[model samples]
Target: MNCTPIVRQHPDGQSINYYGVTLFDEQSSKSLKGIFTSWRNLFESAPNTFEITGNFVDWDNEQDGEYERININRDEVVNQLGKIISMSEHLAKGNCYLYHLGK
Candidate 1:
């Protein structure tokens, strides 16, 4: 898979460049779908499918993305959830975003 460029466009029209890329596979995508909800909720903007702008990340609560997966095995989901929580924490600090690329 090709790496998707992650950039943040500020309200002033200036874009901030990020050094690394984030990737998600088919399994990970399916896994995340349970947490992100519908397209209207997660993909609010057209032509920018994998982008999560400041509009969604502007919140102060890091646990805002939490969801209960009662039937799912915790061992399989723990690592991913931990990483997501870490990312949420980073976004909570401001001047950043959560983005990824997939097939």
Candidate 2:
């Protein structure tokens, strides 16, 4: 579950998961959604924030343009996604938060 550059241990004892490093546009949005459809509820349920310590966004309130999509090799993402999920489970406990920065 240890991935180089993806999960880096900070000096402050914080584990940084670089799952959102990929940037995607409108074109890949559909494809990305297709891959993540199964985890839609999990993602939509998690709390999200625009900044590190900003107000949380109401997932139900936002209609569109809420999150960014990823455009990458389909197979590559599939593999990385699995790794990230495992890492999350191993690293996180009760409530985990998702951070989103729109384009």
Give the candidate number with the greatest TM-score.
1
Q: Evaluate model 2: give its TM-score.
A: 0.24
Q: Tally clashing residue pairs in candidate 1.
A: 0
RMSD values for the candidates in order, in angstroms, are: 17.7, 15.6
| lDDT for residue 63 in candidate 1, whole number 0-100 | 56
Q: List the residue pairs that clash in candidate 1.
A: none
Q: For model 1, where is the 10-residue window of minimal lDDT?
A: 7-16
Clashing residue pairs found in predicted model 2? none
Models 1 onward score TM values of 0.28, 0.24
